[model samples]
Target: MNHEKLITLPCQYPEEAKNSFKKLIFEEAYLLFIVLGTGETVNKILDLATKAAGSNQDPGMVIWITDYTVVSDIIESLNDPLNKLNDLDNTYAFALSIIDKVVDVIKKDENKLDILRIWKSFQLALKG
Candidate 1:
């Protein structure tokens, strides 16, 4: 893998991201998975995944993992009327930036990303 640019991964290119994720299981002898989260719970989860994979780390694949739950948690916490980040306009705009990124990613592989949402957070309930 000579294309060593700074990959802020869970890559925008769906095909490449899917390929990179699968390629190592057979090709590389060992795999280490890291799940970055806040504090101890995350620590435990990371320990479970990495330790489960065990020992040989760094096959150079960096995957970015996250969800809307973080943002939704912030909104729920700041439901107070006087909170600075509670401003409707700014919050909506911030949300739209995330939407824009999703739009760009979907343009790459709509079906695959939709399938990703099926396992991740598609929120079909949001429609009704």
Candidate 2:
């Protein structure tokens, strides 16, 4: 994997990040979709992230941040008077939505101490 290249993919905006992700997926056809398309389960996604991080994809960095963090970072980086994410890609929007749902589930789980704990458990389960 090309760590430098993937690490350089801008996460400041949704459009750029999505385009970069799409580019990487296209270039490394066997990196993500290869595993995801199969019935590899959640580990496939985590494995892809690790593989991409080892390469130039920086999937770990992308997945590490929470939905609120991503939104805050994007908003804070903006200079326009109206801080809107209208230019973000559909993939980013979809990701945020999924994270939102995960957040909701964690909220109702009652067993988890916090989001970080939930995330850790989720990762461990995937690894297992």
Candidate 3:
């Protein structure tokens, strides 16, 4: 994994914002790992992903914070030579792309400022 790139990705944001973003990313990734580890069929995983994303709150957040060891394990699994968990990487990439498109749509909307404000507030809450 590109650790340098991951560490620098949120550098443009404020310190607190960067931390929160990192935490959120980790939480979501861990959640993805759990879902993928279930070894479900592709259709089932897709359905679970949709439900997880749409839920009022992420079930994974119940764990409060993820451990460093867990993060390391996730990275190792993704980097495994056997490509056993490649779907996890692909699903994560696809999810991020979808999020990027959604954000682009929101950016072009007239209520972008309002939406951004709400998102910022949400991020602040997450940080705490």
The numbered model that scores best in lDDT is 2
Residues 1-128, candidate 3, lDDT per residue (tens digit)? 21111222222344544455445554443222122122224334333334333243442211111222234343342323333333333321112211111111111122333324333322332332
TM-score of 3: 0.21
Which predicted model would earn the best TM-score? 1
- Candidate 1 colliding pairs: none
lDDT per model, in order? 0.27, 0.31, 0.29
TM-score of each: 0.26, 0.24, 0.21
- In model 1, the Cα lDDT at residue 68 comes to 23
Sorted on TM-score, best first, the list reads 1, 2, 3
Candidate 2, residues 25-118: lDDT per residue as tens digits?
3343221211111123323333444443333432223232223333444433333233233333211211212121111112221343433543
lDDT (C-alpha) at residue 58 in model 3 = 44
Model with the higher TM-score, candidate 1 or 3: 1
Per-residue CA lDDT of model 1 for 1-128, tens digit only, reads: 11231122243455554455344322443221212223444333333333222223333221222322333432344223334333332221111011111111111112332223321221211111
Q: Which candidate, 2 or 3, has the higher TM-score?
A: 2
Clashes of each: 0, 7, 0
Off by over 4 Å in 3: 1-40, 52-54, 61-74, 77-128
Worst 10 residues of 3 by lDDT: 97-106
lDDT of 3 at 59: 23
